[model samples]
Target: MADKEQFFSNVYDVVAAYESGFVGAYGNPEAAEALRDQIKSAGGIPDGAMACSTYKLEETGKGKLSLPFLEILKLYPDCLPGGAQGRGDCVSWSSRNAALGTMCCEITSGIPDPNSGRLEGAPEVTTTARLNGVLSTEAIYNWRRHGGDGWSCAEAAQVLLNDSGLWLRKKYDEIDVDFTQYSARNAGLYGSRTPPESWRKIGENHRVQTVTEVEEFEALRDLLANGYCVSSCGSEGFSAERDANGVSKRKGGWAHALAYLAVDDRDEIKKLYSEPLVLIQNSWGAWNDGSRRIFGTNIDIPVGAFWARWSDIKNRYMVAISGVNGWPPKKLKSYGARGFI
Candidate 1:
């Protein structure tokens, strides 16, 4: 029997081949059919191989390859390295507010702190922690009821970091706030709208250094490489279609905020087919076929946690945030151009 690592390697190779247009062409019918024939001639995925859902197969044409990739990784829970499992939980609040606290915590304190009693370095950031770090949904609700209104991505990001010290994990009932009443804004300059003075009192230790106008994916990649997760504002209209297996696939969409986590370089595929993808940690729960539950027990994981095309990012507005102990030197050197201290 093949060991798990070897099994995963085989899966990776299959995916790389598919992405390289060898097994099946992605996004092309005739090419996909031709490639499928080639794969059959070469003997299809080996018997006893893990199978991906039909939806993933149709969407990426490598569903057979992709599904197993995620599943195999789950088998080795210890495989995730330092700070890899950011925040340890998914937030299901409004897209506008759900990610702020988690993103802030991820970029500032490092997820899964070894001292926090999690999976060694994988400390879980509670949903309560996220709520406390940001402007509470209760505040947003009250503001709107009094006719104050919505917040911009920048506002959400800034307020959370600026008030990190004041963040407190309250009982579920006390913090169970609603975001449906708030409106959403696509853009805002970091720190342009200061958080209310009252909310700003507690987070003296948390500070933000904002980097804006980052037009290149390489910069985003570099930031992730350096342990900094970026908060981006982009169109949410990206269609999220699910296959018969209920695995979610991204289409196109309008504006929203997302925390950029890691990138699956697939260097071999990029060298041959130019299809590098980004991994985003979404506030939504596990949207993939309902197989694994990400956060402790919540199953309604958002559908936003999925791999996305680089082009999808290029067509949208983006900004990167670096908190204290999280700032990369490249970002620091380029601060003169569109950066805010």
Candidate 2:
């Protein structure tokens, strides 16, 4: 930013992501990843990753939202025990609970993209979610906290990939939490250190199989468009107050993590945000104001979600996107035959 730089010193073949062939609107899934190798070889945003691609709209994926997550999250507000956090466990909340939960729901009960006009085919979520809802932040936070206030998304991802697998809310199959219902107090207490071995064993059954960083904005869009979830930690700051269209403007930088559940790159929203907006689901429940209206539609997004412009997220801010097994998302153990009371 301070100095105008043209090239990157080297190139990196980014690790592949969501290889089941749900590449965004792009023809080749590898196109965005290929741009990376040359950038490091050619250097610098491939002639500027931020500026060069501004307003490069994807007509197909405009206004993508995770409706399964929205309805389920609201159906069970108990899934979010404490509305806001008094400690620093956002890394777990963002990556584990919000991001992964969204992906899991999409896999298990996703409706055809809303644009498909097939809302009638949505799945029955009452089997597991009616009781405990989704993954527990209490089970996830402490492992990454390392007995401190903060942790990185990568550390949290490793815990999911190799350490302890996912732990559904306490009501169902809890990890190490002492109480049953989602507990903010428990989340704060475990906000540090690696979890106990028992937690590791319990979590394995539901662990996510893949998590890779996304460099290209559209690639990240594809992940969400195709029903994947992403968590990003960065220095970017944003306002809690949203505009009429539900867009949040840059306020400064907050060294924290948050989950992105949806992306709206529709050509029409530009009149309001001037660029595409990604809906960020914050760890602090009901913290941001204003409601999100799907662009060009009368449908209103439920509370607890807000939109952030892409311009605010370009470059330097790395995104960790994730997905589960199978094209339609397999049934996990948390809700195995023993599911529900």
Candidate 3:
């Protein structure tokens, strides 16, 4: 209990500091270091605070194939490739989830042979072919334009997944759409163009279940254990932080969508912290590539993926989208209030 209380207090202090004119520090390494020193001097952080590191198969001795859901990645490693380039942000991130979900369905139900002529009612089509279709930032950005900026993570994920067959199957070069022009034409809506009323229609086209109230740790573990990825949205945690010159800095809060790939076993992670850690893949390209290495050893997070504590996720995560093979189960229906339809 003392450990939990101390962790919460530390989080509160850090969030308060960031909200109270220390915002720039979050994007500046030198400034963040100075702020950390000040916090230490003020005794804000308690002794014996738990520390967690990003999940790495090698470091944890847990191979990706050991987890059934992640095994698909071995056959289709590029299914969740990174490179949002600030264009897609949450939209692209959610699209990655939708894509991964589709791939999982293919793996579980078996991919339809392109020459089988059974594409009409097939459970899933070619995984790589589908990935090739939606991998473009411009393609996803054009679909379901909500506001001038970007759609909420849920809105984007729902639309992209539901309409994936029509949009996600086409190659990038085959489509000639300009996201900049699309955003300019459809500016200031503040919500998804598809709207909540259209969810039923959307679901008719795709097999996905959106849950607003997840059991946090257990739900995520179960979903991953079943060979599925969860698409999540939250206003906390940092995917990437950089300064004016594009130098990576300290990690901080951001409203974003990410694909929850896997979590380290509770037994192994409990060795370092009071809670287990989850592995998430980000749309942001490699963390160490180019000018993005400023995060340094302070956060041992890798490029495109990182480990987040379960406590933080429980507190800040808002929703999760799990792909289903047939009709969504009855247990998931209780969490239906989260669906867009």
User: Which candidate wins on TM-score?
Assistant: 2
lDDT for each residue of candidate 2 in 1-341, tens digit (9 for 90 to 100): 10111111111110011112111111122533453443345333322224224424233354554343454354354443234443455566676544444444544454542322322222233333433335556666656444445556656655665655665444444443443344545765543355666767776655555555566777666556655567666656677688887777887556666777777766577666677778776655565676567666686554556778888876433444443322223354575577753
lDDT score, candidate 2: 0.52
Candidate 3 lDDT (Cα, whole model)?
A: 0.40
lDDT of 2 at 78: 43
Question: Stretches of candidate 2 above 4 Å error?
Answer: 1-82, 105-133, 171-176, 188-193, 325-341
Tens digit of lDDT per residue, candidate 3, span 131-245? 4323334344444444334344445444443443223332223223322222222212222453233423433444333222234455455545444456565545552443321
The candidate that achieves the highest lDDT relative to the unseen native structure? 2
- Give the higher-TM-score candidate: 2 or 3: 2
lDDT (CA) per prediction: 0.33, 0.52, 0.40
Residue 90 lDDT in candidate 3: 49
Which residue pairs overlap in candidate 3's backbone?
A: 287-303
Candidate ordering by TM-score (highest first): 2, 3, 1
lDDT for model 1? 0.33
lDDT preference between candidates 1 and 3, better one:
3
